[model samples]
Target chain A: MAAGDSGEDKLIARLFGSVATHPGALGLKDDAALLAVPPGHELVLTKDALVAGVHFFPDDPPASIARKAMRVNLSDLAAKGADPLGVLLAFAIPPDMDAAALEAFAGGIGADATLYGAPLLGGDTVRTPGPFTVSITALGAVPTGQMVRRATARPGEAIVVSGTIGDSALGLALRLDPARSGFAGLDSASLDHLRDRYLHPRPRLALARPLRGRASAAMDVSDGLVGDLRKLLSASGVAGTIEASRVPFSAAARAAIAAEPALLETALTGGDDYEILAVMPDHEVSAFSTFATAAGIGVSVIGHTHEGEGLSVRDGDGAELTLARGSFSHF
Target chain B: MAAGDSGEDKLIARLFGSVATHPGALGLKDDAALLAVPPGHELVLTKDALVAGVHFFPDDPPASIARKAMRVNLSDLAAKGADPLGVLLAFAIPPDMDAAALEAFAGGIGADATLYGAPLLGGDTVRTPGPFTVSITALGAVPTGQMVRRATARPGEAIVVSGTIGDSALGLALRLDPARSGFAGLDSASLDHLRDRYLHPRPRLALARPLRGRASAAMDVSDGLVGDLRKLLSASGVAGTIEASRVPFSAAARAAIAAEPALLETALTGGDDYEILAVMPDHEVSAFSTFATAAGIGVSVIGHTHEGEGLSVRDGDGAELTLARGSFSHF
Candidate 1:
């Protein structure tokens, strides 16, 4: 390393590895990161690219951007009950980005990698135009027949979710257009939580291990719970009924929702929740809270699966709310 | 199953299984794409992004750009002698690009993927500014004990190249900045070959299987031969000697080189070659050619490995020639 070399590379080098790592990665110093799967286990490999404007705000803080990129990938691994082995990051840095910003970005990536216990193996970095992008390809391992999929939810399954939903979308509302209600009157602590959810949402990797063969249809709530749950139901070939009142919301979230009635709609439709939604057999419903508690996470009974056609929200009186569907429509 | 509907859930239907395809990817309807990996063999992945103006000229044909992106990734897979299973492409199209051009780009990707027997598994798309960046991550499989590494080259091994060197860089020079003497009066056929070499060089996937149990040190020649070979030498902790007269150049390339003595230097030092460079004991030389021939590829020798530090090139008389050490230094 030269005294006046590019500082970002040096910082990235300092952060690419966690505790123990593959010996080959240490020696190769090449761009292709290498991971050795454990014996008797299969690997689940996933890749995701976060573009500057499309995925995140153009002026998003580099630290938050880095954390979000890693977190989104972790969300995928979490959905499958997969153990983190390592990851490869392919980044395109704009020419204008200074070495300091790049250093911070790399530091954030290192921090998240360390948090998730996933090593940063190897990657290639190149220069690009104004709106840059970061693509992370995460590799994980799971014992054969233990990984979860989004297609096995039985018709009479119980729909469940970990953590509160809509905070991330609410946070985006504040960041992009402050005129949107609910977020404007948020308390300091609530404000902080919202930002964290938007910028560095935690992936439920720890919960994945225990949910191994238990959860039926499972996936992370990326595009808001209602929206994501609809897709889950669709994939499972079952319809779902999520009680709007039974939906769990933080105390602060409830207060915010009260301030802006429109906030409920945003929370239901706005994307980027990143919580995990799983469908389990009706008997599994009684065990949901206990399982989540044992895993040191919270679980909420968000809905019920039925052998019907479309997603429906209901009230205490068991009357359908008349809303058409659950979440974001890509079309 | 709807009336005349293609069943494609628009972009959302394509999101899942976009990377690390699940075996039952097709089952995740109306939302995510699903394609699964087979058991036993783990995945070896590599990604590279090419920006339009930064990577190729703005006027460069979109199909060529698309092919080049896939080629670059395939070259990486070839370096490991891994079998091409599938690929994930993350392409950023400039908003100003013509719709036909974008279609051509996608067609080019589909065409090449089919050509190499590697299908397009999944990917994400977005809009970017002028320099259109195309990022591709290629996945391949190698037997547990067969994948080659760059760190295994030993001292006293012969440094050999799979094909003639310096053509691509010379070809690049002709396409970009055509005022050079070698291309100033070139015909379209000559220019087209040069452009194709620069634009869509083939990745030697077929050689991967045979090279797996062989090739002490190996890597694709993305940079010019001298420079890339230097990487192999450095990674292997050895040095090399280049037989300049033995360096195979195309007929037109030689004629072009004759027009300007410096053209040889460009060919020698320029990159984007996409060939393979390996180090092996003298005895394995014949086997490589035979293997390559059977695989329907080309191979040639241009150098020998030495005991010490830097690269040395010799002319027909076997005396060192005065030229730059390597091509495309990391500026």
Candidate 2:
């Protein structure tokens, strides 16, 4: 019943009200907010920016834009096994961004932060003349020494992946041309599922804890398999091969891409996968799969590391299938 | 040079560098960077934005703009006894903004941050179609129970202000219309000093620790004396009055304003003072002043908080002089 209970002020209260912290916060009445770190958790900090047309579809719905903004940052934290603590968002909007759009974007941000048990810490807002931009600086806390690194892969380690790899890329292609998905029996529900997954990625923070001791040199597949895996391998000073027959693909994706041989390479090299990719020692592979199954997440053995420094994938006839090593670059 | 020396490669290095102890941060080679917090210090976070026309003059030099951006945020942190730790800059530029201007702006930011001992953390850059905008989110730390709050002022507390007041607004007015300057004696050096101070404020962060136990309540003066002090009184549920004879003014300010009576009132109430206003118990006033002087900062006793709920300033013989509280109002 206060006069300030509408618009940005209201949105701010709703976004940050759930943050439970030490008594030192003073309930957010000042220019800045305060937070205390408990003894057990180490803080994790990361920042990312999503520019209009640069990071996402410029015409994407506001909610989707908001979701992408938070999700990508969350994905980074997930790869580290850091649970979401809170986020600081600095948003610059063009005057063309209407009031309804702004409100919806804020709503989406609040929803995701609450869903992940993360609170909104603080942020800045400004108006620009050009396109919309959202920058989120995330903070999380994890127990010390449990984080996975991308530079620890060993030779002979089995390359493992979480969920499916090709779905997001396939979904993106379909979304770009919604009319004929080219899959004979594709249903609306399946299309929607893929679209949702592609639009909003689920960070594998859950697997971060379980993968700590077993998986060496882990990272999320943002860029497609072949591309991101190359970086992972280069970091670890190792490389490996995958079987073309084993590149996981949904039925719809397979049907759509079967006639276009280049599609396989595209799907393998495209970015935005947001799935976990790691190297597990052969002896620990079984236990790792079991642990993943217990957690109700998918795990697959896709390839293995070799002494050489590049990737190689063979078809069923044992002939090598050439591939590209770079995906979407940030610049 | 090392492999990371190239501009393009430098970005890759920056993204992958510095993974702290937090479990989710395995280094930045993946899609996001990770970090961990150190122990002991409580976090103080503040955010402020500057628009091209609204917050500043359009012709301000790029270095001054950057300096003002950090200064405004620092002023907020100083009010709470917070030591500035780092800053995140989110910039939105108009397409027409020159490349040289932008480079100068960035250089200024680098210089100020380095001088303050707070390095850049991370942020975003984007193109905008509207007014040029700069948003800064700052991080500072203070020990538990050491920060000040505006709402904690007692009824009998003495009110004090740091540094000279009314100079910036008067200085700005003179700069805006050189021909209209009331003082015929105004010279280049004096005008330059006043102009620089108006453009680039100095936040009193060093005084945070010194004033920790001294002041009961405090805040920065962004909106001139009466305006900002009105805010303090509203927060603390008290009323105050300043003696007109006791109001602080510089010799130059007096000379300039004497030509126009209305101009004097504007200076007294104009906003963006960037000074600290604090309330202390009457007994601690002398000690506070002494402490400030020892630190090489100026101080003045302006007013006192009484049990009432309004603000006023009285001339000699208790005659009230009605004036607008300093600064412009958005609405």
Give Cα distance to truth, residue A325, candidate 2, Å.
7.5
* DockQ of candidate 2 (2 decimals): 0.43
Candidate 1 lDDT over residue span A1-331, tens digit each: 0001245655545544432155535432542544557776765656667778777876778888888888887887788778887776777878778767777787787788788987766666776765768877666777877778776777877888888877887777667776666767777898777766777788888877766777887888876777677777776789888888887777666767899977777677676777778888767765666767877778888788889766887766889775444564321
Model 2 chain A: weakest 10-residue lDDT segment is A1-10
Best by DockQ: 2
Tens digit of lDDT per residue, candidate 2, span B1-331?
Answer: 0112235345423432331222333333444433344567777777777778767776889888988998888888898888887776666666677766766677777777777755555555555555577777777888866778777877888888887777777767776677774745666666666676689887877677767888888988776777778777887899888776677776766667676667778677876778888988888878877877887778788778899898888876789888854443321
- Give the lDDT of residue A190 in candidate 2: 67
| lDDT by candidate, in order shown | 0.70, 0.70
Tell me the lDDT of candidate 2: 0.70
As for candidate 2, its interface RMSD to one decimal place is: 3.3
**B114-188, model 1: which lDDT tens digit per residue?**
788666655555555535777777777767655677767777777777666667787778866788888766677
TM per candidate comes to: 0.90, 0.82
